[model samples]
Target chain A: EADIYQTPRYLVIGTGKKITLECSQTMGHDKMYWYQQDPGMELHLIHYSYGVNSTEKGDLSSESTVSRIRTEHFPLTLESARPSHTSQYLCASSEKTGIPSEAFFGQGTRLTVV
Target chain B: DQQVKQNSPSLSVQEGRISILNCDYTNSMFDYFLWYKKYPAEGPTFLISISSIKDKNEDGRFTVFLNKSAKHLSLHIVPSQPGDSAVYFCAANFQGGSEKLVFGKGTKLTVNP
Candidate 1:
């Protein structure tokens, strides 16, 4: 029932392959974030966008890049996938109007690079 | 350094029992706390939240207590059921900024029937 959506719920690809993970929300939220979580590990903010034409790298240093061309879409891309890139990528969106931006997440995309 | 920590990795409770999950934060700037529950293979869902102004916030069987002085918070689930079994995460954020949530590692709770 979550409005946010991530494509390729599960993906297994060879190393050196380029891939793009698509995330879209219908809620028209101005804030979008991409978090990376490994099994039994804390979630790490990889990238975020305040609004269209505004994007920044998060606390965690990641080789991935993200772009937000429209309010409803935020796509993360890896120019070259590696074994270290295997992890669960979660997409979330929140409204900026509140004091605390409580996020709504989409079912994560589990990626495995072999 | 981990600003937020959930010391216990896992907890087990019997059905209909009260389940208590603990969280601690080191950042004084965090003024709001939130709890999220996640099932396997799914994203975390917002369970409950508390503002800096209140010590306690309740939603049905779930209650969150924030002790700002101790930099700690706890989530209580009374009469816990099997369906309540999930990984719970504690998150915190401040007001002056963009309000990005800093999440703890999470504690996995198992409710035995």
Candidate 2:
């Protein structure tokens, strides 16, 4: 089983509130990613990190920011939450090696900005 | 334009029957494809994957067939079980280029027991 974990399985906060969603993985993976998904929509990549101090924006433009200071931890933060930010955030990781492999995902964090 | 597309919004199959889910991609540069299973309020789990070099890949009860010429792929599950009911997402990326994986809208599979 994958060792990835995401905190705050469900969160509901008022508008303009700042919040941080924590994600960590016990597995030593070089690549980490954050994806956002809405109901009946595809999972869109928002942020990704190749390694520590190497973060890149994903295909989808997001108002959130992420930091990869540790190999095992990647956190996503929203400075000012809005109702539009309500969605499920998923964290995933994969090893960087000879061949591309499948990524293991955490349970995910559901954020609701009321 | 969406790079990947899962035209079917949902699929239903009876128990012990075969269930097939299809996916199409617009980007020819994508050489790697993957299928992920997800439950409600949970993250997607890696189910199976296929490389462009090969046309077919099978693992246990699941099989993935890729057609490069048609830019289409399919996932087939035999003897479908109720536990297999979940949302399946098709993802693709350039294996030799970028690490970003593009995903489709996903197809919810319902296995009736």
Candidate 3:
């Protein structure tokens, strides 16, 4: 079956280290998004891409950046990781057609910066 | 400030009972609402949704109720089972130029067998 995938289900990196979280989808969706969530907390949208080479920041201000070189891949990168940046990063993809299109999410990457 | 709010952080219910999860939003412009279920170590999956125009929508054992006047929405799961124990999130979209969603803090449900 078609699904979205995220690598490094868990990551523990030192502060100030640069890290990249990988997200890929097999569904060929044009819209992809990245959300940050603390444990047992609300999800905050950080970055999103309408399509290849088109990326925009979401409602939340995030220090991380994202790139959409291919429709199936949307990766998030942090220049210098901080303890505050440690959280679960979830990747999702959805088709922009109807009014209530459902989003398919990846398992998510848990990052811990010490 | 949180635009969407799920006041209940956790809920417990007995098996075969009904589980009602509630969500409230401040943005009246939101036209679409969705409910998602998530398990540990896994991503959230779409459970059900309702539009602003619809008062209610049902799928199998899950039913979503939308109250536009109160700016509130709820998900009701009848005959709650042990497998139904997980975190549920409510999301709302303005449905304007950008369809970015505003999500509420999830509520964790535990169904005792």
On DockQ, the leading prediction is: 1
- Which regions of candidate 3 are displaced past 4 Å? none
Pairs in clash, predicted candidate 3 = none
Which 10 residues in a row give candidate 1 chain B its minimum summed lDDT? Answer: B92-101
Model 2 reproduced share of reference interface contacts: 0.78
- Candidate 2 lDDT tens digits, A1-114: 999999999999999999999999999999999999999999999999999998999989999999999999999999999999999999999998746678899999999999
Show where candidate 1 strays beyond 4 Å. none
lDDT of 3 by residue, B1-113 (tens): 99899999999999999999999999889899999999987888989989898999999999999999999999999989999999999999967648887789999999999
lDDT of 3 by residue, A1-114 (tens): 339999989999999999999999989889999999888888899998889999999988999999999999999999999999988999999986755577899999999999
Could you report the DockQ of all the candidates, in the order they appear? 0.79, 0.78, 0.74
Task: Please report the interface RMSD of model 2 to 1 decimal.
Answer: 1.2
- Each model's C-alpha lDDT? 0.94, 0.95, 0.92
Candidate 2's C-alpha runs over 4 A off are none
Q: What is the lDDT of residue B84 in candidate 3?
A: 98
- CA RMSD per model (angstroms): 0.8, 0.8, 1.1
DockQ of 1: 0.79
Indicate whether candidate 1 or candidate 3 has the larger DockQ.
1
Give the true-contact fraction for every prediction, in order.
Answer: 0.70, 0.78, 0.74
